[model samples]
Every structure is written in C-alpha cells, then in structure tokens.
Target: GLIGKQPSAEMERKYSNETQVTPQTPPAFIFTCQDDRAVHPDNSIRYYQALMRNGVPSQLHIYPKGGHGYGKRFTFPYTEQLQYLLTDFLNEQLSK
Candidate 1:
C-alpha cells in the first residue's frame, strides 16, 4: 500500500487532503470512475463534498467504468468526455 500496510493516526492526518480543505482552498476539478480499484470513488466524492461545504468552486465527474489511471488512454470509454470537461474547467478558470 502507498501509505504502508498499517498507517498510523498521525500519518492519516498528515496525508489527508480533505482535512486540510478550507474556504481559502483553490477551486478544483475532480473525477473518478466507480470501478476504480486502486482508489475508491468515495475518496473523490468526500473531497468534492468538503469543497462544496467550504464554498469552494469545484467540479466532480464520476464515470461508471474506466477503472483507474486511465488518463489520456484512447481505449477508455470516457476519454473524450474527460478531456472536454477538463478543458472547459481550465478555460473557465482562466477567464475568471
């Protein structure tokens, strides 16, 4: 495991992005697949929730398939959609 087999409380606290989320945090674009085995979709969901709670601008996209680490892979079902969404987010941010 990336965090070691048994991560202690201090390690968890130190590595937790959600816990560090605050109103001042920058906007985010988050996406994940429901079938991702390496990282649970709930992690994205929870982080998005935290961003929303803090009134931070954010976008979240959860596809049904595509597993994990599918970035820019032509075979991934939602590759085009992901690219479009990411581009749109970046454009919107830049225009702000």
Candidate 2:
C-alpha cells in the first residue's frame, strides 16, 4: 500500500534496501518476534535469507512471544536470551 503511495520511483528506490543487498553488504544480526504486530517477522527472515545467499555472515533469531520494539526492556520474556545472542554475535564479529 505504501509503495503505491510513493510520489516517485526515486522515493521507492531509496527505501528498497533488500534490492541493494549484495556480498559487500556488512554482516547482519537479525532479530524478530514471531508475534510482533508492528512489523512482520517474514521481513527479517527474507533479509537473512538474502544475506546468506550472498555469502554474508548473518544470524537470525525469532522469538515466539515478544511483540515489538522490546529492545533492552527487562520485562520482555526473552530479554536475557536476546542479550546473550547479541553479545555473542558482537564478540564473534570482533574476533574476525
């Protein structure tokens, strides 16, 4: 719907990050919640798949419950797990 509302082709192209993904794209840490209402988890899954197809290093974590925008929120059920995953990803990246 938003794509149809774009004023011009340039505006659409400017936000189409997926089409721009390539081997040169930086490594990614993709995290999403399956039940998020704000943004669909499939977007993350597709991005991770794209990164992998291009041979880029990436990690994808899809938790079952947390809705959306739960970053650093202690009350989120997966807060500790998210922290561990993110920290481990950063450490692994830094070692490279």
Candidate number of the best TM-score: 1
All models, RMSD in angstroms: 1.4, 2.6
Model 1 misplaced regions, further than 4 Å: none
Count clashes in each candidate, considering only residues at least 3 apart in sequence or on different chains: 0, 0
Model 1 clash count equals 0
Residue 5 in model 1: lDDT: 78
In candidate 2, the residue pairs with backbone N, CA or C atoms under 3 Å apart (3 or more residues apart, or in different chains) clash, namely: none
lDDT of 2 by residue, 1-96 (tens): 345654687865665556678999999998889998877788788788889899999999999988888885767898778789989999999999
lDDT (0 to 1) per candidate: 0.89, 0.83
* Model 1, position 53: C-alpha lDDT score: 96
My TM-score estimates for the predictions, one after another, are 0.89, 0.81
Cα lDDT tens digits, model 1, 30-91, are: 99999998888888888899999999999999999989888857799988788899999999
- Candidate 1 lDDT for residue 38: 85
